[model samples]
Target: MNPFDRRPTYFFGVYHWRERLRRIGASLSLFGAAVVVGRRGGRLRRLLAALVGVTALVRAGTTARRLLSPVPWALDRPKYDALASLLPLGDVDRALDVGCGSGRSLVGLAPHLPSSTHVVGLDVFDDRVILGNGPQLARRNGARAGIDVSPAAGDASRLPFSDDAFDVVTACRVAHDVPETRRDALFDELRRVCAEDGTVGLLELPITPEGVSDHEAYWRRCLGDAGLSVERVATVERPGFSDEPYVAIAATPTA
Candidate 1:
C-alpha cells in the first residue's frame, strides 16, 4: 500500500467550503460575460473576450482541483505524518494543540504518541474561520481518528492554561491567522504554557513562493523572542495539495 494513500477510515472535512463555492460562482460569472461579449464584438473586442474566457476557465479549473483534493486539510497525510515523526513525543505526558480547528492536526499527532498521553484541543470554534467548526465537530473528527479528544474554547494570544502545564504543545498553520500586532503575544503564550523542558512544534504554510524563506526566518525570530530555543526546522512538501512547502519547527523553552 502507498504510504501516502489516505486511510479509508480517517477523514477530515474539506476546509472552507464557502470559499470554494464563491470562487466557482465568480468564475462562472466571468465566463458568461466573456461569452456574451464575444458574440457581438469586433476582432479586438473578441480577442479580449477570449482572454477573459481563458482566464475564467483557468480559475475554475484551479478551484475545482482544490475542491476535490483532500489536502492541506484532511491531514495532508504526509505533512502531518512528518510533523508527528519529527516532534519529540516519546516522554510527553500531556499535550495541547492550539487553534485545533475540527481537531485535524490534533488527531494527526495523537496516533503518533503513546495511547496513554492525555491530549487536549483548544479553539475559538468560530465558524467564520472554518465552516462547521466547533467543539462538537472537533470531537467527532477525533473519534474518526481513533483518539478521544478533549475540547476547550479560548484565544491563542491568551491561552486559558497555566504556565508550564503541557509537555508538548503544537499549532499547525495557526500563527499566521493572528494579527501581526498581536502575534508576539501568541508566541509568548505558547512558550508560557510549555514546560521548561517540553517541546513545542509549529507547522505553518507560506502564502507566496518569494516569502517562504522570509516566512521561516520570521517564525524562527518569533520563537527566539518568546524565549524558546530553536531545535529543528524542516521543510516538507505537500504532494497531495499544490506541492507547496510546509515549514515545521521544533523548539524548547529556554532556561
Candidate 2:
C-alpha cells in the first residue's frame, strides 16, 4: 500500500520512527563525514586521514548498526518469504497477501503463483496501498509472471471477500494489531473465503506477549475456532534480522 498521514500502526512496531531515525541519521552522518575528509587526497592526506580516520571507522560502525538495528525497513518478513518458498507457484488464483506493504512480497513471490491465481493485496492504509502499486501492477506484471495482483482497502477483522472466493489466504504479522476479541472474526473471514482444500497462512512477528505464545498451539486455537484445522506450523528464526520469532501457519477448513 501507499503512505499515509494517519497510517494505522503496524503491530510489528516497524513504524517506530525513533529507532529508525537514529540508525538512518548515524549512517548518513558517517557517510557525510567520510566524504568531507576523503576529498583531500595526498600522502600528507593519508597522514591526516590516519590522525582522523573518519571514513573507514565511521562506515564500519554504520554497517554494523544497520545489521543489528531492529528496524523493519519494508514491513517484509520471513513469514512471507518462507511462504513464497513453499507456495505452489504457477497461476495463483485469488491469492491474498493481507497487510501487503508496497508490494515487496507480492513482487518477489507472486511469480510463483498460478497463472490462474490473482494476487490481491489488502491493507488498511489506503495511501500506502495506492503507492504500493500492488493492484495496478498485478495486471501489468500478471501477463509476464502469469499471476495477477490486486490491491484493496479492507479491515482484517472482517474482509469483504465472499465464501470460498480464494484458493490461498495469507496474513502477515497482522493479528498482533487486532484486539483479541476480534481475531476470531478475522479468522472466520479468512476461512469463509478459502476453497475446500485451500490454504490459510497466518504469518506473524511475535511482539506482544500474546503474539509470542506457543506458536503451534496458538494457531490451532485461532484457526480451530474458525472451523479450520492447522495443517502446518513452522517457526523460524532468521539470524541478524527479526527481533520477534515468526511462524508460517498453514490451515485448512475442517468443514
Highest TM-score scorer: 1
Per-model TM-score versus the true fold: 0.79, 0.62
lDDT of 1 by residue, 4-25 (tens): 8965354455667778879988
Cα-lDDT of candidate 2: 0.63
lDDT of 1: 0.83
lDDT per residue for candidate 2 within 93-166, as digits (tens), equals: 56887766445455546546655566787867543313333345433433343445577878887787888888
Off by over 4 Å in 1: 1-8, 30-58, 69-73, 207-212, 240-244
Ten contiguous residues minimizing lDDT sum, candidate 1: 6-15
- Please give the lDDT score at residue 248 for candidate 2: 71
